[model samples]
Target: MTPRPFSGFEWLIAWRYLRARRSEGGVSVMTWISLIGIALAVFALIATLAVRSGFRSEFTGVILGANAHVTVYAQTYNDEFGRPTRAIRDFDGVAERLQAVEGVTRAAPMVRGQVMLAANGRNSGVEVFGQRPADVQTIPLLAEPERARGDIARLADGVAIGQGVARELNVGVGDKVTMISPNGVQGPFGTTPRISHFEVVYIFAVGRYDIDRTRLYMPLSEAQTFFNHQDTVDEIEVLVTRPDDVAAMIAPILDATGPDYFTWTWRDSSGGFLRALEMEDNIMFVILSILVLIATMNITSGLIMLVKNKGRDVGVLRTMGLSEGSILRVFFICGASIGVAGTIIGVVAGSLFAIYIDPVFGFVNWLLGGGVWDPSVRFLSALPAELRWEDVAKAVGLSLGLSFVVTIFPARRAARLDPVEALRYE
Candidate 1:
């Protein structure tokens, strides 16, 4: 009687063929090579996807945590002196209106000035932001006790400096620093530079080297005085409940603040960088897919070899009333078994690596005497990994698909073996 498709006997015969001894012409060796190749490829793909996801998440989190989701700038116009001036004279009213808008969490009127900071015989140019102490406390990064040192309540008493700036200026809490601005006093000769002194009462490390290295914060009153703005603010910084929804909030925000003010979202400022990241992610996925394909090609080579070595067996089975379809299924089972096993192994390994990436990197850094990750250079304190289920599914599907597709030609060749010629040779 003809055996049912993929019956017990088919599996038995396929497994027996796979277990062929090494002395039987190295079929098992090739199987191991194919299995290892596929496993490593899947692992690499999963690990890369996890890192990409994590990096994007961390970068965006930093951007939103340390800065406003949207900034509303006053329209610049030629003054009576024909010089361009941009300031919101009704900043408090506009900010109160913006805070009343739906989805707005906080609306802070702030003064921003570019100045040179000098302390301990060291000097660095930095951007200074001036806001109320209450509003300053709303900054997520600054609110973190671990990331920020000193008192937010005393912000009006002095100033808050970034960790990198403190390091550069060799100053800390209660230390003195002088700020010099080019937009100081208008004298008969030209514009006289304005210089002011303040004590640093807080220091924050926001993880992004660029921001940490060049940011300082002062009380709004002090900043307005220093920047020569009388009862005016440079912009109104608005924070929303969901930063990702800032684009959708533009209309409501404009309606609240009136048309005299134009809004700039975080996306508008850093959109190109985020787009570049997305493009890199897609390119990386394609490259890794090619790698998985290459690894699965080994399945083709191993199956071809297995078919050649099992020719005499195929001939005998065909003579014993086994149809060509049964023969094909038998060999298909052999190749597919390796693929399934390898994929399972790879998924487990990749998931674990992503989950425990920090400790794994710690071990690696220890092995190499430390310094594997540099926050100053990478803009993150440590390597990050976020395993996504969709990425894992994609890897599994690609691996198994390539394996099955490559097995077909070899399985068909085995099924079409001429019984008469095969047994004649035997």
Candidate 2:
């Protein structure tokens, strides 16, 4: 009776061939080189994908957490004096209507202005956001207790400064900060710059260098007074339950706010940057896939050499009643075994590296004596690595697919070896 495919004898023969010593003209050294090459390639692919995923997540999180998902701006229209005015007069009513919209979590009216801050004999320019105390606490990143210093409760009575601003101005919570606005009072001669003092009621670090260095939060009432807007607001900041769904919510948002108001989503604000990131991600994957392809080529070379070295064995096996399919299975198993083992090793190593990236990065930074990554330049305080199962799966599929495909050519050559010629050479 014919035996089943991949029987114990076939496995035993494959194992014996793979375990052949270098002195016996075996391809042992080449096999090891191929294995290591595939492993390193896979590891690199996985690690890079993880870092890319993590950076995108962190970047988007910062954008959505600290800022509004959508902003509503009133159209510029002629006032009683025929001068164009862009301020929203009925901001409270507008905000209330926006809050009633489905998917909208909150709508807060705000005044935004550029101002120079002076304290401790240092001066720094910053963008000041005037928001209600209650609304200020609703910010996802700032509301974190560990990320914030001092009381948010005092935001109504004082201003909340960013960590970088506090550091630059050499001021802390409860310290007085002087703000000078360019849009000051209009006098007979010209407009004089408005200067005002506010206590730093809170300090926050959102892990973004640009925002941390140039943002200041003040009470809505105080901001209105400081900016010379008695009761009007510059815009209404809207937060949604799902920021990614902001696009679909735009029509409803416009319906609620009327035709005179225009809406800007976070995607509109950062679309270019996000698109660049996505493009980079695809390019990197393609580049690294080339690397994986090059690495898998080693398996082909190793198996070709193995087939050449085992020519005499193939002749003897055929004479002993072994079929061509059996010979093919034997060499196929040899190549596939190496591929499977290497892939497993690579996956384990890459996953561990991604999962413990923080400590590993810290160690490397320590060895380099610090400053391996700059938050000011990178916009994130730490190197991020987020291992996604789908990315990992894609990598595995690519590696194994290449390995199996390359092994086929060499396995077929071994199976088709002319027993007469092989035995005559032996």
Q: For each candidate, what TM-score against the reference?
A: 0.94, 0.98
lDDT on C-alpha atoms for all candidate structures: 0.89, 0.91
> What TM value does model 1 have?
0.94
lDDT of 2 by residue, 1-426 (tens): 677889999999999888898777588888899899889989999999999999999889999999999999999998777989899999999999999999999899999999999999999999989999999899888887237788988888899988989999998888998999888999999999999999998999988888888999999999999998899999999999989878899999999999999998999999899999999999999999999889889989988988888899999999999999999999889988888888988899889999999999999999999999998898787888899999999999999999999899999999999999999956
Candidate 1 stretches with Cα past 4 Å from truth are: 1-4, 80-82, 188-190
Candidate 1 lDDT over 1-426, as tens digits, reads: 665788999999999988897677449988998899889999999999999999998889889988889999988977667989888899989999999999999999999988999998999999999999899999888877337778878998899988989999999898999998889999999999999999999998877888888899899999989988889889999999988878999999999988778999999998789999999999999999999888888888998888888788889999998899999999999999998888888889999999999889999999999887887899777788899999999999999998888888899999999999889956
> How does model 2 score by TM-score?
0.98
User: Against the true structure, whose TM-score is highest?
Assistant: 2
